[model samples]
Target: MSLALPLQRTEVLVIGAGPAGSAAARQLARAGFDVLLVDQQPQGRDKICGDGLIPDAHKALARLGLLEQVMALAQPVSHVGCIAPRGGRIDVPGELAVLPRRELDNLLCQAAQDAGARFLAPARFEKPLVNEQGRVCGAQVRIGDDVHEIACDWLLLATGAVPKALIAAEMCERHTPSGVALRGYVHAPSMVGRIKAMEVVWNKAVRPGYGWIFPAPNDCFNIGVGVTDSHKAVSGKGSKKELNLRAIFDAFCANYEPAAALMREGKLLGELKGAPLRCTLDGARWSRPGLLVTGEAAGSTYSFTGEGIGKAMETGMLAADAIIQGKAKQWNDAQLREAYEQSLRALKPKFDLYQRANRVNAAPWLADLLIWRAKRSPRLLARMSGVLRETSNPGNLVSLKGFSRLFLE
Candidate 1:
């Protein structure tokens, strides 16, 4: 059963008030646009994530003037320790930060509100309202029992991966090698002293992707595993019911003596949540006249490190800039698409190349070899770190001279 509704108007409508949507709304509102941000969840909603923000992510937030607020709630991480399946450890010196997604998202939304963007939380989005020509004019939203049609000049979809509305409208195509991420927060006994670092352990049992233990504030930590669906099928892990993440954590603790000691004193703080990870670059279509998509809705996440915060912020900012310029100039779909694609190319090539390399080197033996080489050679380590940080151009991959210099010299 469907009901027709009267129309409301706004200058800009941003869907999904996550990091990407909030960032876009904040920038657009600061630029003097009347931005209306909407999300299905209520305020202070929690998201499932490792909550580890790398230094580059901090840099992006600093540009948006939200660094101080984020720092206030975040726990500093000064090192990243990795344990290989072959039983060797490598410690890298760098700064990272962690905070629960609840705090971070709330802070970002507050910032958006302060910048003059109106928010409609707990507002369920039914679908995009497409014009006769198929250009999205706004969205059909349900607030409580009533459905309202919102009119806008532009619609930005910052909705994350599971955007059923967009998929139903045939605006997005799904592709991949999808995977499952199981995450939870727990209290563990202080191992390796204080909780100032994030630890990644690559064990045989954790295939395709790795397991991570990231320190959160107040002696709490986020523990998670990312494993491809195909890997799970091959491993004969029955079904999701039989392969619960909490059980996997217990198994890991049992197998690893050090981890076992930590769990003995640790408390299981909450219910574990499972989320899907799209492993391929599937959704690349961005604009159709009045419609534009950014962040995970556009597949801006890097498949390699599972890091989307920085990329989402970057894309959101670029989208705002493009929208402002396009609206002012009355640009067409081709023009907007060109601008958006250029923005993605500018901000994404290095990270995309890194993801490609990771997919190519998916085998544990190859990963072990690369890690060993990186650990042994300072220059290689620096180059790898630079790639990870997205501070270098991926064009270096095509340059024979640069490749030789990086790996051999």
Candidate 2:
């Protein structure tokens, strides 16, 4: 991963072809900027995720003009099933769907390409090229054996939760991940009808995280357990975490009847895979001179639900919009970077509220209370649906006052 190479040029060099990168690349390319999207992996690579596309994700896809195309290939869901520790449940209706990341990311990348962005697969980003003033001017990437230095006016880092590329670019603030998760696919037409909604289970066994069983395409269910708050301490001593994701996943299937039934009846489509999560949007510097961080690289995933897809795309487009406006207004580098930081800062309050909501995952009894109340109160269920849709502040549901009011309201 050395840096010496030829001087290929583009206005934008987008590293990591995830939702964030592709979204940014597509927008910038469509706006007439020369953009290139690069990924370490080739197309068709599977990304570990729960695969549940909620209302916010649907909205983002619609903004990108890919909603209909994506839904055509996705497994439509009626509602999200919430399961509590004691097995009590509630179904909160919302616009939801599930499609494996293998297809979702590929579709996004293809959309970016169709929108006129150059794409290079198996192209690994080595490091950023900085000018004399320390502003990132371009990047050096390794494609096969050759190293090529591609110059760009702006660089968008969308490298997901991995810290290596962030470290190379000197944009990473926290080396440790905010969380970790394990994902697996199970194929069972019999279980498909049985588990109709996107089922999310919270129990003491999976505290600080949760388990999900969502129907994916081709009679498969995407099943996984995510330790969303594992990066922090249970008490106040340290934030460093020592977790066994596999053990927790096993316990989830053992303790939850639906998960157990799915495991018993379905054929596990593949061996389980794990991925790191950066949540609460605090793990990285959002922007510096001539560079911006997007997606999980900027902590787009929610600490409460481990859902990052929509937020990633939203942040990516936000970053692109910043650059697009900066150029139109002829803003200085400092002004442009400050604007991006301000935009990211505006998202902080919501992310903090989501972190507060993570308490439900840490405390199983709290989930039970919410489920109990939600089943009894239509108002509570609507609020839960609102939270999923990103229209309601999660704090309202997790705060003590909100819980107490649930019974009376």
Question: Could you tell me the TM-score of candidate 2?
Answer: 0.96
lDDT string, candidate 2, 307-373, tens digits: 9999999899998888999999999999888888888889889899998988888888888888998
Candidate number of the best lDDT: 2
Query: lDDT of all the models against the reference?
Result: 0.71, 0.89
Candidate number achieving the greatest TM-score relative to the actual structure:
2
Task: Write the residue-wise lDDT of candidate 1 on 1-409 in tens digits.
Answer: 1122456688899998888899999999998999998898976888877788876678779978999889888888877776667766656666578898899888888888999998886788788888998787888888889888999988888887674755644566553324557788778756536445687766666655667778888788887776543223223222332345555665666655555555566776878787765433444466776777887777666665566677777778888988878777888777876887788767566555656554422454545655665577787666655654666543353344554654674
Candidates' RMSD to native? 4.7, 2.7
List the candidates' TM-scores in order.
0.87, 0.96
In model 2, what lDDT does residue 69 have? 94
Model 2 clashing-pair count: 0
